[model samples]
Target: MMSQAAVRQPINVMIVEDDNVTRKYLAAAIQSEPALQLVASFDSVQPALAWLVSTPVDLLLTDLGLPDGSGVDVIRACVGRWPDCGILVITMSSDEDSVLACIEAGAAGYVLKDAGHLDIVRALMDLHSGGSPISPLIARKVLGRMRDAMPASSAPASNADARSLLTRREAAILNLIARGDSYGEVARTLSVSVGTVQTHVKNIYGKLSVHSRGEAVFEAQRRGLLRMATLKAREPG
Candidate 1:
């Protein structure tokens, strides 16, 4: 096994936002951190996807609404390509559907656009440190949803089986993929290759006995491996 010292490395981040102003601001924030390297910034999903195919990164900070497509697509591509990469959805949308959909697709963190730069920085650090972070408001919404989903008669079982079946990293990647992150985004966030991400995904699928993303997500939900609200609460801000 690799030593802890050997495993430690600087994080590479990518920002995908349609607004030039926002993109620049995010890039600047990422650059402010000594431990984080700003790899690239893009205005649309297509170029970001293309860049991801050729380059490697550690994290993806994206807006849900993009010029060409939804930020969710960017997440999907990243998770498909980079399974170890961390995915954080930074968007203006606070609608429950948008939040739930992103979580179901595999986002590790979700923050509203209103969140300050410090919050975003803290969130990125939290995610890098293996913590799932969500905005406070988002967390409340997620908690409410979880409460609503729970059966009144019985408490939900902790997904010890599923948790034991996969490493924390694998679970994180799977969760993001379930939320909507792309292979490329996953690769970048995890600082691994796309092929590596695919390998992990394949392993996850085999272990879960699921074929498609939908099936994997359903299984994850059934196994109690993913609690939509719990993940949100784990976020930094």
Candidate 2:
């Protein structure tokens, strides 16, 4: 007998946007996606948080500005209640405070409203599939922010020496990643296979003792291991 193909379950998704038009557009886009299922959509944090308390969702696309509270609260709720669930920010707020707060709260993706419906769907899908899909421009800004947050004090000589544990190729890959290149983009730039990029990234993350891209960037900066590209941004224009 021929083996039956394993069925794939649609990802459960939720939305929390106060704007009627934007919410409808995002909801329709997600609903129409074959791999996504609209578990629940809310206009405020209260209802969304309530729903999350009882229901398990795979992904959450939330706006930073809610009728009741900032969506960071919702992100915190999801991170706290459902650690496995992926969280995404679908808001116009791209400022350092907003982005850093969401990332620190365990959001896996950040999408601005200007990215439009298709990009939003792509980001949701990417985040749900163990990927962190931050826009390149936003990623650049985030890297700059991470570099700027450095303390006035210098790292211990030993700390800097410890960063030398990264291989030359791994260091190069980390710099490209901090510059906002995706795995595919990194592979293209280096003229290597996508799996090669993944391997390098995994090695870099392990060497740096970080679990996410944001953490990798921050840890690089902390250890004085960030490349000249990121280090130069700290210079005044």
Candidate 3:
């Protein structure tokens, strides 16, 4: 096995941003980063999702809003097909709902498009390295939403407690989520792929009978599990 500190080769990255200027900027940013190799950049989720199935991509930086379909489809495809490939979001929508949807769909990092080239490059690097890179404002928004909805999710569980439903790994992942760590961050911390992290999270959600991260956190807290913060990465109803 490779050492933890060992550096891997340049990550083969794919971009799926829709804007022309943003796409050019993303391509340039990837080209400039020594650790990143641009494999392909597309304007929609359809072609990108199609490309991801057959390609061995190391990283994927996609936008949430595309002309054809939302970027969530792209994230789901990558997570389901190329579990090893790390995924990041670069979008104008920083709403808690949108962020949660991307997270539930299996994105590792969520960064806004307003970020500069260096910021984007850094976020991608962090994500590729197993870190959850989210914008500051977006992070705060998530926290606020969880806090606001805490009352409703505070109800107690029966003999089949929420905590007992999840495995040890799932519990650890929930703790990381409570601490505001992204899927990629949890994966890196556990030395697993982003997809694996999402799988564990999905199992956790299933066991707790929760849909969103915030609901999970609230449910865990109600059942006297790991109590810290809240989040939920699922599509809005």
Using TM-score as the measure, the top candidate is 2
Best by lDDT: 2
Query: What's the TM-score of each model vs. the native?
Result: 0.63, 0.82, 0.64
**Candidate 3, residues 1-237: lDDT per residue as tens digits?**
887447656689999988999899889988998878999999987889779878889888998889999999998999899888788888889788898888888776777776444367777776665556666556556655655675654535442465567788888888777655667667788999888887787787788886555556546655656644333342122
Which stretches of model 3 miss by more than 4 angstroms?
1-7, 115-118, 152-237
lDDT, candidate 2, 4-92, per-residue tens: 43467778999899999989998899977888999898999999989989899999888998889899999999989989998888788
Candidates sorted on TM-score, descending:
2, 3, 1
**TM-score of candidate 2 on Cα atoms, chains taken together:** 0.82
Descending-lDDT candidate ranking: 2, 3, 1
Off by over 4 Å in 1: 1-8, 154-237
Candidate 2 lDDT (Cα, whole model)?
A: 0.77
Residue 85 in model 3: shift from native, Å?
A: 1.6
How would you encode candidate 1's per-residue C-alpha lDDT over 1-237 as one tens digit per residue?
A: 899767777799999998888788888888888788898889998999999887877899989988898988888888888878888888888887887787667677777787554456767886765445565566555555665676754444555555788878788887776554556667798999867877787788888996444446556765667657544644554
lDDT of each: 0.74, 0.77, 0.75
